[model samples]
Target: MNILSQVTRIKNAIAEVLTGKDELVELTMIAIVNKGHLLLEDVPGTGKTVLAKSLARLIEGDFKRIQFTPDILPADITGIQFFHPKHQEFEMRPGPVMTNILLADEINRATPRAQSSLLEVMEERQVTIDGETLKLPSPFLVIATQNPIESHGTFPLPEAQLDRFFMKLPSGYPDFHQEKEMLHMYRTKNPQDTLKPVFSLEDILVMQQEVQETRVSDEVENYLLSVVQATRSHEFIENGISPRGTLAFMRAAQGAAYIQGRAFVKPDDVQFVAPYVLAHRLVLTMEGTMRKTKEQVLKEILESINVPVESEAGR
Candidate 1:
């Protein structure tokens, strides 16, 4: 609960600029606490870039931004080795990925090779250049933004890379009142300017450890697995949730429980986080897509599974 207060401060601070999206904010925080990266898939001018930057500013850590483009090279993000004339040696230079918070803007616009540069660092938190590997800073998080409406000069992210993201969220347009408030605030000054850091990188690292410590009862754990397994046997799904995704779902459930001041995860915790955690990882059959979206398919999976009783859930 003490951690809840700190995280609440962070959420409220970010809400100043990202109006009317509290659930999205909560989900984003969950991703952070679980040490998972995010992919923001939405149309332009939906505050995707602003959200990424605000999150970076909210934590006391190094922040870096990379604008993904067609010409971007692998070395541009993961770092490069350059020859030093005076030293007569090749010096390894760290790129934007070396920072604590990285905002990968319009990531889909980059070539696949350039985008693939992030795989190692995202999964292993280390970058290799010229046969030398360097560990990235602790609490490293990548909040990547992509415009779903644009296709020209953009390369689609492969399924392997997509699975790396813990969640793919949409930054939808704000409601009327929220938009009005945003306009009023923008007339005077950017709301993000007044934002301040509420927690430190060290705090985040500690909180991440706490999230993993959150308990999952045997029945609740089985329920979670049942949902994942259903995805695999579903008639419409070509590929179901991967083992990595199964682990991600458990981690996300733990984060959800921690946020709600609970020491143990419940079936509700898994239900709340399952859709976001599983949607993108699925490879649907063409018939499935024609009948329903990935979200809809996931919804069916959740509905079909029997949730554990309260007694079984240790509630």
Candidate 2:
């Protein structure tokens, strides 16, 4: 199947369980296609876990869920070297992170050390244990969930760790009709069991490669940079999108273009995917926080930023 067809099939498969959050689902797909980790922050009972599972199932990837808690240790996540009497050497056991699709359930509940263990794997796709580096499975994607409503027992993720994630998505509660449909659909049995893979791991990898080849015009490139530059200069934001954030935005826009069956990105593609790609990387000033929601601030920034009509016309 073509890249667009693959994306559509994947979306339809996940939508079987996720229901009406098409935009969020699409963003999740884009992140995966772009080979970026995702952070799903929302209240409980919003199907965050289910969404992760559904994505795993639909992609036919090896899925592992790590329940992050205060008691969890870094060794528990990255595994440890254990002495083996029979082999006369220490054996390294792989952790849940070894899998292709990793669901870090309630990631905030884990202590800083446990959370820090993920940094290397998330960025480099490899884990260093006992000074030995082990590569993770191909097409590795982490879909982490955090409850935004509770802060009691949870260790807040540091800004640096937060920046590691490509996009921080809020999987909000479903609408009235969507919830009703969900109730009806799950009245007798769970719907997730019925979900099947629409594409294989190899197919996903192919699409990721295809996305890289998607042409991003100089105009769109300049527009993307302009938006990122604006965020840095904005009075409301204490710190804005980083260089890494700019790269993430570009990848996400390419993913969006691939999803739309386009080989080249347009200005609209960047705007459509900007908020999810940029919002989490932003740290608003206290005044900005008091005055507006991050989403509101992002929207205003997008509105205020001018789009380049042509690439060389200005030059």
Candidate 3:
């Protein structure tokens, strides 16, 4: 019931291991509580994988990781139905997708066929194996990490595939002070080794249910819709946020409010989560790509829109 305290404990727990990345941890938590998938575009050592592992421990949930490569097949990720000679029958085996938290590491490395395999489970939270459908664990989340700098042997995710993610974050490098702190933190011991769960899977489920209950007003709804419309007509954008994205934008605002321990959504909440939810979904025009990044163009759009009165937001 106390969303702030619960979120605070979880963030502090993750901060112990992920030094100087407080904001990243917060966004990651928001995505998790919303039961949305995460797409992390970061360089090799920005603690993307650690973030997933830390979340798994925080909720006392199952954590499974798959290192995606070109040779990875759909069966490798979703499991296969194999025949047992001794038993004289066929048995179904579930893949890593069955876990509570799944880390699809270097997701861009896998071929389109292999990548497409996750489409069903991610959206439906269930896997079909030889005509038998198996449900994934409760509070399931996919934290898919990809290397942004490496193009060698990498297959870029198509627009449809990218839309599956709830948000895309670049886990930027730590600052000087944070980097120095990290060296000492790891010098003593791996913080994760002693890390403990801040909340149970049941708690997470409760938060998910409760986050949606956070109120979104007509004013805030209109403001959000305006942003979605901006992307569609914006000169620099080739493709704007989809209808699914529009829903995600609103949901993310609710999640942001829930994390802040607020009972109602505000224009501030909508503004705060805009970049994380919308930037990656925007397809930039050639001119846009050459002139500005997605975040920059999105910022322009945000500046152009008028924010609603704060007092009226709670009503």
lDDT of the candidates, in the order given: 0.88, 0.86, 0.91
Candidate 2 residue pairs that clash: none
How many clashing pairs does model 1 include?
Answer: 0
Where model 3 places Cα greater than 4 Å from the true spot, the runs are none
Q: After superposition, how far is residue 302 of candidate 2 from its true place, in Å?
A: 0.8
The reply for model 2, stretches above 4 Å from the true place, is 85-89, 308-315
Best-matching candidate per lDDT: 3
- Model 2: per-residue Cα lDDT at residue 78: 82
lDDT of 2 at 127: 84
Cα error of candidate 2 at position 126, Å: 0.9
At residue 172, give the lDDT of candidate 1: 92
lDDT by residue (1-315, candidate 1, tens digit) is 387787788778877887887888889889999989999988888887788778878887778999999999999999899999999999888899999889999999998888888866899899999899899999988989888888899998988889999988888988999999888878878888888898888888888888988999999999999999999999999999999999999999999999877899989889999888999999999999899999999998899889898888985
- The model with the greater lDDT, 1 or 3, is 3
182, model 1: CA deviation in Å?
0.8
Clashing pairs in 3: none
TM-score (all chains, Cα) for each model: 0.96, 0.94, 0.98
